[model samples]
Target: MSTYRLSNQGLEIAEQARQAKRWKRQDEKLARAALVSVATLKRFWGQQPIRADSFEHVCRALGLEDWQRLVEVEEERSLDFPQFAWDEFWVGREKLVVQLSERLQNSCRVLMLAGMTGIGKTALAEKLVLELQPLPNFSRINLDHREKTVEFSAIATQLLETWKQQISDSDRRDPQRLLNWLVSYLQQTPCFLLIDSLENVLRGSEQTGWSEFIDPLWVQFFQKLLAVETSASTVLLTSQDSPAQLVELGQRYGHLYQCCVLDGLTPEEQMSLFRQIGLLVEDPVVCDYLSRIGCAYEGHPLALRVIAGEISQAPFDGDVQAYWKRYGDEIERVKQLQQTAEIEGPHDALKLAQYSRNLRQRVRQRIDRTLRRLTEEVPLAYVVLCFGAVYRRPVPERFWLRSLEGRSLDENQQLAVLDALYDRYLAEQVVMDGDLMIRQHNLIRSIALDHLKNLQP
Candidate 1:
């Protein structure tokens, strides 16, 4: 779909017409008459692109007869979006898709999807973007593949160079100017922006505290985006943990910013996904077995996908019974332990056992990256996570905080470390018996317990 803005002459004529009709910038009555948002009204006055229909709405609202004469069709800016291949039949998250779609269209300015690795945040985001009826101009950046020293300035430079076509050398050299220009440009130009793996740009090592942006400018960029009340643009961020800084911004500007914590698929969703992957979930025994595996992994998409592929491939050939005979023990072990209390938990820390070699490798790689960052940057958080693995069920926050007792940390510092785990999504909060509780994912607990012995005193 095409987008249109106002030309210099059109802007002048529209302003005149609007003034004659007593319409003013951000006028609620004008917005209601046009059937558009206040942001859309601002976009109209600012000469930023809006949908052709919305442009017509504004023109009609102003009592302009020649809408075509007042329009300036914007030249489409081609963006290099990431290549994603999705299944023909998407499995689930029907409600999430609807919620995100509506939010992006009407209300949300900065929406973040935060979750553990392989939890399907990116996949769901991709699905939403792909299915957008009139896909707007969009761009994406993979923040994970970058050098540690690279700052937001470099990214700003590339964006300015790409969309704006030309920028002064001084602007490119000055981080503050570049940031200002970029923010201003986004405010006046409607575009969908996606930043993946935001954690990579964060100060996530033991040397640096977790969840703060490594580059201070990044913090400023988000702050500006959230503070702005008039914007036609939307930003989507996918991160393993919601940065504490961004979370604070969301708290302050709750109307403009939102964070969704992605979790595992539901049981029905899990079964649908398995069936789509050509697994024989029709058999009652096989269906029950697959559900057990789903329970074990908490229906983690990537892990479930890998296991399904393994079950469908050569040696097993869609035979769940055969696959279960081999890997069922490992899955059952987790299910059993997860249901047990701390008293009945495993005596020996569960050693790594292969369910599917591919599943283990992928889950481990993703988990290792987070753990390594914790171990390097916030060792206290890492220690806390290791200690947290001892709990089979969700426990009070005090338990995790108390683990750091007798250490050098003060109450504030101790709370900060525990929050670090929460921010990283290594620990999850649950409600039990009307009280809030916390626990780690089964896969995370298994790995953490094995390494708890290795942690220093």
Candidate 2:
């Protein structure tokens, strides 16, 4: 569909109209009306114009006649968005919350949480943000890989506005000046900063100032800030891999930095989430089904969330067991898709080549990155990855041990291959009836199996 973006003037009108009508706090409502995500709306609030159709939809939602009419309203600059506010229905993790709070309160200036995909790190970070006081002093920046423009200056400028830190527009665009101002602001006013998907900053190709110099330089600036006597109240980061720079800082200044490797939710928490999401909780058989499903998915939060959503929707009509029997495998693949989420712009049959190219790039890039790395680093691990892909069920220790037939690796070497897979978050380990079993996500297995088939010659 053709999209519309709100001009600077139109954005101001939307913001004023939203506030005057009490739609500011109703973010989900505004997002639905605009046909976009809350994060997308937050971009508009940050003065980054919205899509054409989205602008019209938002204008209509806010009782404005049209985009042209919205532009007639004077621009409003005295606005500070507190970002997204979600009504959290989280279950369990009281102890973890207490620990996180204590770490931040103490001398720990930077707290890092690392874990496998869909382990609820981001959700917990949002919860901690909500629990903080002086909500205006707290803000989050999601370094989402999908966005076309995610410059450090853009984020820093938005943050300064949110925090009411006065800096010239020209000065805010300069990395050194921005960091200096940021350190000064933190020293005077303690702020809680939560940055999610931090690895995106470090992983991509050399593109812009942020990708090459500014990002690495920003780290050095933070290193100095952390070393100083006066520093932030807390800086939190969540990512799949731990930044080695921060790890070293944590080692040197143990009191100033802390890293927490998150684990999957407890069985109780998983079951509780399913029940709270309005699943078929009353059914006795549903409980048993959830228990099995939960274990199969390793109690990953996103997997359970998708399952809860699927069962709660129509056609199934609250028949949890029926849905389980029919589309359990299909439902499991949703988790994999989420890890490598992508947005496909409108295309046509006339653009068949373009469409096929986009399709191949999306399908190949996700797991191939890791597979190529594994093949180079450890050939044995690559073989294990390929051979193990044939089995859909969780492979037992003996089954994996036997798969080393064509490969000449010893048993210990084979076990190390499994360890490498788990380390990369490509595989998961499960304890089924006290027996350790290894499993990969449904789509992940399919990808590896396809690659293996191509190399069969």
TM-score of each: 0.78, 0.59
Residue 247, model 1, lDDT = 80
Taking every candidate in turn, the Cα RMSD to the unseen true structure, in Å, is 16.2, 11.6
Off by over 4 Å in 2: 1-87, 146-158, 166-174, 204-214, 328-424, 427-457
Local error of candidate 1 at residue 181 (angstroms): 1.1
Tell me the tens digit of each residue's lDDT in model 2 across 199-230: 55653111110112226655665587688887
The TM-score between candidate 2 and the true structure equals 0.59
Lowest summed-lDDT stretch of 10 residues in model 2? Answer: 344-353
**Alpha-carbon lDDT, every model:** 0.77, 0.61
Local accuracy of candidate 1 as per-residue lDDT tens digits, 1-457: 4467888889989989888988677675565566555667777799887766768877888888798888764542322344442333257899999998888888799999889988888888787786674556587777877464459998888777768558777777799988888788788888888887888887753432457887899989999987876887889888887677888889999988888988899999999888766566788998999999898888888888778767766687678899889878777877577666553352435533234578668776778777887787788898889887877778898877766889877667777787788788899788999999988888788788766878735
Best by TM-score: 1
TM-score (C-alpha, index-matched) for candidate 1: 0.78
Find the candidate with the highest lDDT and give its number.
1
